[model samples]
Target: MAKYTLTVNGGNKEVEAMEDMPLLWVIRDLLGMKGTKFGCGQALCGACTVHLDGVAIRSCSLPVSSVGEGKITTIEGLSEGCDHPVQKAWVQHNVPQCGYCQSGQIMNAAALLTANPTPTDEEIEQGMAGNLCRCGTYNRIKEAIVTASKSL
Candidate 1:
């Protein structure tokens, strides 16, 4: 086991784990930050999405050691009291079914808007492409993203 000090949600967090352990386990298991979910252990599913230096990344496949000095932002850190524009838009649009993947969805949307404050509908879809919502709330997700863009 090795020691890693990760900057998560604006704070420094020290943890111990195997070098090959995924960041998802570090965030969820070791750090006890549960908002970032584990869907497919592979990186294919964005259910474990988190911001690494403000870029959306699949934590499930990212080794803890590779994170180095990057800042990690999980859904819990997305905002205070769920006031993030994207989160507000999500609730305004009622964009969840099973709600299993909304955290990842929200995190992905936040990253998208951060990079492109005003994204067209097509761009929203393109940006949210890899993050899968099994409930197929794609339309509502897109609408929420559009609505969130206006608030950004």
Candidate 2:
């Protein structure tokens, strides 16, 4: 096992695990941050998306040790009371269906807004391309993104 110091959800944590252990397992299984989900361990799905130093990343294929010294933010850290504009917009737009992909979708949307506070529809489509909502809420997702962008 290797010792890794990672900042997650604005907290510092020391974790002991195999070097190749996926960061998703480290955060969800070890650190108890379930907001980053497990889907398609091969990283094809964006269900395990998180922010590494403010950049959206697929956590399923990321090794715990590879995240040294970087700040990580899951959906849990997106707001203190889940009052982030995106969350609010998500609720206002009723974006989630089954809700399995909401966390990843939110993370990707958050990253997009962080990069471009006023993204066009095409940009939102490009940014959120990796996230798949099995419920087929793409239009609502884009609408929520636009709503959140304006609110932010």
Candidate 3:
């Protein structure tokens, strides 16, 4: 096992984990932060997305060692009071159904807006294409993104 001190959210977290352990496990298991869910265990699914150094990435397949000193941000870190524009927009548009994928969805949406504060419809579709919502809330998700973009 190797010891890693990760800068998560706005704080520091130290954990001991196998070098090959996925960051998702490190975040959810060792770190005990359940906000980042486990879904496919593969990178193809965006359900395990998180922000690494302010960029959205699939944590399920990312080896913990590769994270190095990069800052990590989970859904819990997205907003302390749940007032992030995307989060508010999510509620406004009623985007979640089963809600299993909503954390990842929110994290990805937050990152998308950060990179492009005002994204076109095509751009929003493309940016959010990888995130799959099992409840088939794509239309509502799109509407939330459009709404969030306006607030940003």
Candidate 2 on 1-152: residue-level lDDT in tens?
98888898899988999999999999999999888999899878799999999999999999988998999999999899999999999999999999998999999999999999999999999999999888999999999999999987
lDDT of 3 by residue, 37-135 (tens): 888988776999999999999999999999988999999999979999999999999999999999999999999999999999899899999998889
Off by over 4 Å in 1: none
Deviation of model 3 at 73, angstroms: 0.5
* Whole-model Cα lDDT of every candidate shown, in order: 0.94, 0.93, 0.93
lDDT (Cα, tens digit) per residue for candidate 1, span 61-126? 999999999999999999999999999999999999899999999999999999999988889989
Candidate 2 Cα RMSD (Å): 0.7
Give the distance in Å from residue 21's predicted Cα in candidate 2 to where it truly belongs.
0.5
* Candidate 1 vs. true structure, TM-score: 0.98
Can you tell me which runs of candidate 2 are displaced by over 4 Å? Answer: none
If both were scored by lDDT, which would come out higher, candidate 1 or candidate 2? Answer: 1
The worst-scoring run of ten residues by lDDT in candidate 2 lies at 36-45
Task: Tell me the deviation in Å of residue 58 in model 1.
Answer: 0.3
lDDT of 1 at 130: 94
How many angstroms is residue 30 displaced in model 1 relative to the true structure, after the best TM-score fit?
0.4
RMSD of each: 0.6, 0.7, 0.7
